[model samples]
Target: MHEAEEAESLLDAGLRALFAADLPVGLALLDRELRYVVLNPALAAFNGVSSEQARGRSVAEVLPEAFPTLEPRLRAVLDEGAELRNFQVQIEVPSRPGELSEWEASYLPVRGADGAVLGVLVQAVNVTAQRRADHAMRRSEAHLRQVLDSLFAFVGVLDADGVLVEANRAPLEAAGIRAEDVLGKPFWDTYWWSHDAELQAWLREAVQRARGGESVRRDLLVRMKDDSRMTIDFMLAPLRNEAGEVVQLVPSAIDVSDRVSSEARFRSVFETAPDGLALVDPQGRLSLVNRSLARLFGYTEAELLGRPVADLVGEGDRARHEGLMRSFLRAPEARAMAGKRHVVGRRGDGSPVQIEVALNPVPSAEDPLVLITVSDIGERLRAQAQIQAALHEKTVLLQEVHHRVKNNLQIIASLLSLQSRHADAGTQAALRDSQRRVMAMALTHQLLYELNDFSALELGPYLRRLTQLLHDTFARQGQSVELRIDAPEQGLRIDLQQAVPCALMVNELLTNCFKHAFPDGRGGRVHLRAACTPQRRVQLELQDNGVGLPPGVRPGQGGSLGFQLLPLLADQLEAEFTLFEGPGTRIAFEFPLPPVEESGHA
Candidate 1:
């Protein structure tokens, strides 16, 4: 009986040691009333209490926040001898208030000697971190799926065997098919390439290559949703793993139908162009030549390609042509090659071909290229030479006509002078006036012929000469009259239409100043000024410091021919003729300059 007592004490001590063992999992024992009977340090800490404080406390008192959930399960284990394994629960504890933590727990009934349940044993593990990690991974996968589906290009993933597993939204919608239509099928059996058996076979091979870590790309023709063919820039590449092994195949494609069509159109236009066209590289070598250019140089397109451009030029001009080509490549722009001059090229037969060349620079990001247009101008040059010769003959004939006109006027002036010698004084004055007028017209023709331009003559020099002639004709031997003329150094010019009338008007006005202004050998100074106005008209002013005009003697109303001719000539020129009241007669007039097309060189 003493030994039995010692064993009972030892057994109690062993039960206490077992419950005190340090472990990460929480352990506890509850009585039939759901009161704490035995609690480990971990289980007491999970309830926010010490073991000594919780040993005799009810579970509702120690963990009030979790009592509602734990009481039912604890009661089941104690009264019905039920056992639970791996049951998951979410609860709040005193240690972390208002925050839920996840736990996985198991409960087993503890039986007495009569097989009746005495208490419940509990085991629990915290699984909050693992649960949170799993939730985050699911969110990331959803985002990645959204991004892949939003792309415009056709994109897909295939297994190592080339069976399609995933496809993006763009290509699926473009073909008016759902993902289920193509997914799980072999890549070559998809709607895009299945229409062409040969293309499908090629695609199968390409997929195999991609699976072997090879990248394949090509421009391929594929059937579209409308059953029409379209061109695509397609690529198949391997998706590799960390070990550098090809794990999956990735297929991508972009629609390139418009680009292919544009290239075809450009080729057609280039081959059928009428002008001789050639493309020259920065090195002055012919990179490409059209049919027209090959024919012009008497060489086939293949024969001209890669040939130096200078080789086509005549031997004498080859060196100069090469230098020009180099200069053009340095600073390229669109321009004529030789201006108006013809370039001489040597044909394949060694014959000379006169041609006009135009140069245009093609834009490039790498090296400069020149587009040269060669035109055979042999016939054109011949036509131009004939035109120039004919023009020269016509000029000579016009000059002769002007010389004859001047001679006839001189004859008339001589005849009038002879008549003046035999007439009365009044009649002699009239005859001399007519002769002077004839001389003025004759001088204009004489200047035109001398200048070899019948279009126009210098007004300043013509006026100076005419005035000097008048001064010589009218100035008396004892008279001391002074003459002053002001004009531009380069001289103002008027066409024949205005020049003839202007000369006649000046002759009349100056004759009046010489004949009527100073009388009986009374000497005076005469000034004539000519200038261009700001309004682009010509301004002329004739002033004299001689006896003023008589009262009431208005110009153009007088009976004399000179006065009568002034207004008529002014009317013909459409000029503004004004007579200012001053110390002497001041006559001013202005007329519009000819349009640029009608104006001539001075």
Candidate 2:
């Protein structure tokens, strides 16, 4: 073979091998006709034609519609007379799966020999997968674009160089930027701000990580087109080539202004909580201890972190503390974790202090965790001591006052008793009634001085004491009565004002029961019960198994001083008064329990 024939033969062989490879190759050969002297199987198979059909065809013969830019590209190659590799082009071919014709092509150029013109070579790689992928990617890009358009958020994409290559309509419109003005510009160049360094630094880190094959997402403050910057949360990724080298960055952005403000508010509340707060791990160690908690144990957070919670509890309290932690892990929603409870915490010196603890289990404290609030009750204890001192002084003063009042009342009773001896029957009866009233009031003061719960008097105990006093006073005068006082175990506290009136009313009732009902001098049983009903009304009933009320006058109804006092006392108590003489004489006084003067019972 001559050198030229030999070269053509070698060139044809090389072209065959290049197209036979799966990597997609195309070739075009020309003399003066711009025809294909040789075409590979890849180009032929992709075109759905035989090599015979392609060999003699011009660029316009095989694809009439592909000649627009293609003709120009071919002419350029003809004019330039040089080889080109991997230049991108778009062209349409017959469709598969009954869709429109799919697009395909290559970067076209001329294949040449030394010092001579050859034909234009088209390396038509079947870039269908990449093309479809790009189409799908564009559809995805359109979807994101739609979302970004409607939201109030500022969204944008950045290249790896901190340049704002593209922005959504929202941010662009908000910044008053013309669509064409800011494209392909650095983000910081559009606006100047103090936080530019922060944005740039973090974004650079994200780019570096993206380049290294890791995904990066962060929140940052970015400058806007209006020279104002707002906080935003952004996501970025490095777009890799087929060789996996990062050539560009694709990013998504969202505004997080509200989230940042909300987080700041929540943080303020968490840090300034009045109670000692801590995050105790399920393993019994403390993961986080707040400032108040550190102060509670006289240690800094560094000293308490990772330390077992037992170190801050007394030996007796350690087991209890462990049990609580276990309970938190098991149910977390128990009331014990929600309500306050007395506890003991150990100081740095290993001494214990009283505390009231309220615990709440969160899904996460550092995102998820259990929260404990320990209130130091040491000051409360001291206050209680102070209260005890005051109570002691008040008791002494009250006792002295009671003694003097009792003496004065007794003196009046004694004078009445002494005067009743020298008077006529009507006068003597009046004096004796007045004496009973004095004695009733005197006895109440004495009871007040004796009991610690001085705010209210227990009705049962008061009745029993009064019945005994009445029985003792009248026993010698043929007025013998057996008094039975039946009542519940609970006591009621009545203030001194209520106590005096109630006592006087009781005294008169008992005196009348003794004086009139049992004229036959028979023994009797009195049931004195105090009950608080579901409607929050309090009742005191005085019933007897002795004789009923005398004749036409009922117990609380008419003519007598004893009956008259009932209505006055009822009015004083804001009570409904009822007196009936059914079996014996049962008198019940019901009242809406007054707003507690000082809490009725401990």
Candidate 3:
């Protein structure tokens, strides 16, 4: 009787130890009707059932609400003697507090020592956060659909296999097909344009990208049922399950007919205005001419339609004309055509007069049919000359204002300096710091005055000057130290406001490095490196090989005003700051550099 009691005590101790093990959930069950023989308190509380409720009852009976898809999954594991393993399950209890969300789960089946089935063991992890993220994404999509409906362009939604499921009114009508007729049909089947192997390949890649959980938007031309081409902006995105199975697709189409027609009208007006229109083709043969060309050259409209536009352009400026055309081809879509260079012309009398030419290429049946619209600009040139002179006067006035503002800043700096010489020690120190800050920004404007781009500065040169300013401000106070800056080859252009934050940050960090990083009168080297990654994250690293930070300085924790302001500035720039503690302190700052659109002012 004593031996049996000892054996039972050992068994109970082992069971308790198993339940208390530091696993995700510690539980076990028997195969007989899937009854739970033991469960940890964690599992009990997770399912809101007690150990007593769990021990005798089958898993299905105790938590049917939690295991809606339990039976078949369990049988598969037992029948095959294989682990059921890491399958996800989601169930919505009718009385649960919120929306139903998919939760990930794990399961294992237990067998006897004889290798026979015992029961299935289960572990569940709530992925409600991930599920909520998915739902939030869905809500965002719904919001986008509402916005798309408000646009004038047609929109469409397509499935994985290329069946059109939904479309806005514009595209459906433009395709000249009733919604019912196109329903359930292959996307290409009713396409008014003939499909080629190249287009077939393009569509295949697009579908593959969408199925791979990526979204792509591109311009597509659809030949309408009436044989007219309609350009559309097409977007494709993925719809998938957790298992990565592509179930459906949502496509949006925006008809760009109005934009296309507007371009066409602009081309017509520019080419047919009461001026001679001509173009030099790729082979340098002047091939294009409008009806105005016939009237200007005293030739019949039919005769001059395909004539070498050279007939109206005389020989003296022919070489210049060709050169101008070559240069224009380099940037065909420049805001305006090339300046009206001299081109020779002949009339019914075969006379010559100076003519100004403005050539713009309009996309047409012939690739880039350049329209060399010639106007006798002798009068207009004089008028433009007068206007340009007036514009120059206004620019000079603006420059004078900048000059006056720059002088005012100089006056403020001089006033601060004079006051510092006659003030208390504390006031003197404050005035000197203010003067240094003013000089740093004053140098930026001085640099801008000599350059065209004032809104942004190159990282390499900017950093060089900034550190130089710090060195000049501090090094002159009988302080000896070395500062080094490493930056990428191509400059990272930073906006003016961003420049201030970046400079102030570097200034504070360096001041700390200078103040405490070295103590034994040894030369200290401070390293600064800035790089922009392909992910658009800007990484800025500052490190010193000195004796690391002083023990009393805890980086963001109970430090001075500079440390507190460092985090606040980081918050302003939306940057992440990290400090590594070691023999030498290393600090890294990285974040998405604000995009061009997010910049408030220059």
Candidate 4:
């Protein structure tokens, strides 16, 4: 009936009522020595023991595995009368030996009538399922973040009010910015668009549109952290909830600066090129024409577009041009059309203008196109014609000069021959050699005029003719010396500068063989070969099957005039000359040929 006794009785009654409620919460009361004094059925089940068995048992005896961690906290509460709130722990019960569970517990100090601590009251709840769910949620969020960061594109999440909530690592790193720089700020106010007032305004409107459940996409020029500008293909799409309400905005962007720059450069080149260029569609109709092309045909760009390409040509060639265009469309290739014949284009005023046209195919699978370049060659053709006429006049004058010089040399040779008839024996021989030398010079001029190429002549035919002339003058009447000439049908060409010296050299060598090798009517053979070597040089070899040179008489060291001239001619040709002393004298020389020019004449 005392006041303190009455309060303790009421508290006992409330504890009994709660324990009998059979709730899932674990409740217990421990004595000062941390022994179980009383416990509900739930707490007894948590400890894997009955209430009768757990009562009067020590805390370590009941939960030995968890006692080490819980002993300090329990002592703190019991010794200091402290109230420990919401302390979490893990415990494995005797019934489920390896199965551990999580718990949230609170310990309150129980007081008696004199306000002294009597026992400790414990309240616990199982929170294992909740902790597991929270762990799973964190793992899922980390996985999503990793996936977003791996993307090469910029990605961001915005609240319904257009405030930036999340930005992927790609965009942050690309702009050299941290997430803190833009998170929780308005999307239009971020570094990407804030540099441009007009763009920011447009982006704000676009965000509003997305919030209204509309998707907006466009190419925008955005500024980076370094103050550099780049183009991005940006899009803002709405993310809606189950109730069909827009809850957030997802903004994504991909960098497209390089592609846009390339397109711009191509456009500039197409418009500013000097050649009259036109783009023709697969139908052979002009789709685009540059300013030069429009001016060349005396038509405006508007007038030229969609016009049949064949219409620009003369009427007589229109049908043929159309046919050729059709053939080219079937299998496209790059070629020049003006090389086969003169291409005459008709201007707007029906005047014929000479043109050179080239066609190049553009690679496109869906839409095939041809790039046509037309050059107005009217003035060029006139200039070329004038040059050709002048060149022809000079060629005729050169031929006439060569012919008159050849005739004058022959007259001199005849005079030498007539003088030799009345001179002494030695004088006659000297005059005959002099006459042969003059004749050799004339043969070169004759070949130049006959071949109509004053620049170069084929060495094979030149040597053949020169050798025949020497044989006729030096061979004795009774000697039967046979001559063999071996040379390619083509490719052994020497320029005029080398040809004259080459002719005189061959004349001297053959004349020496005829006069010295086959003396006293002795029959012999002379073989001459000319070929192109792999190292791009001409090789000439002359072998005679007769008495060789005298002992110790090397070529170019003999006392005769022919031997003296050999070294000079070889030097003029930049040739490597050598001789082999054997039964028959073998003389060989090689010299580099000039590089052939584009005209294919050399």
* Tens-digit lDDT string for candidate 1 (1-602): 99999999999998788789886678888888878898887777766788898888888998898889988988889878999989999988776689888888999998988999998888886577446656888878787778878887889999999999999988887777889989999999998887899999999899889988899999999877778787989999999999999999999998888888987996787778987889899889999899998998899999999999988889888887788888888888555343533589999999999987777787642578888888898888899999999999999999999999999999999999999998999999899999999999999999999999888777888889988998887765456678899987554778888887898898998888888788888889999999987777889899998887888787788878888888889987889988989698889889876766777442
Which digits, one per residue and each the tens of the lDDT, describe model 3 over residues 301-418?
6666555555566777666666766777666667355565666676656877557777776655346556676777667767989999997887666556556665677788789999
Over the stretch 1-602, how does candidate 4's per-residue lDDT look in tens digits?
69989998998899789876787788999999999988898777767789899889998999888788788888888789899999988877675588788889999999887988888899987677446767999999999999999999999999999999999998888888999999999999998887899999998899999999999999999988688888999999999999999999999999999979987997788788887899899999999998898898999999999999988999887887788778777777555342334578999999998987877777743576888888889998899999999999999999998899899999999999999999999899889988999999999999888888888888888888888888776554556799999988678888888887888888888888888888788898999999998887999999999998888886678888888999899999999998886888899988878677822554
Candidate 1: count the clashes: 0
Models sorted by TM-score, best on top: 1, 4, 2, 3
Question: Would you give me the overall lDDT of model 2?
Answer: 0.72
The candidate 2 region of ten consecutive residues with least summed lDDT is 94-103
Query: Against the hidden true structure, what lDDT does model 3 obtain?
Result: 0.69
> Which pairs of residues collide in model 1?
none
Query: Which sequence of candidate numbers ranks them by lDDT, best first?
Result: 4, 1, 2, 3
After TM-score superposition, the amount by which residue 48's alpha carbon in candidate 2 deviates from its true location, in angstroms, is 30
The best candidate in terms of TM-score: 1
Prediction 1 TM-score vs. true? 0.65
Q: Candidates' lDDT values, in order?
A: 0.86, 0.72, 0.69, 0.87
* TM-score per model over all chains: 0.65, 0.52, 0.43, 0.63
In model 4, pairs of residues that clash are none
Q: Which residue runs of candidate 2 sit more than 4 Å off their true CA positions?
A: 1-145, 148-170, 178-206, 214-220, 233-392, 414-432, 472-482, 523-525, 545-547, 554-560, 581-583, 597-602
RMSD for each model, in Å, please?
A: 13.7, 13.9, 27.1, 13.8
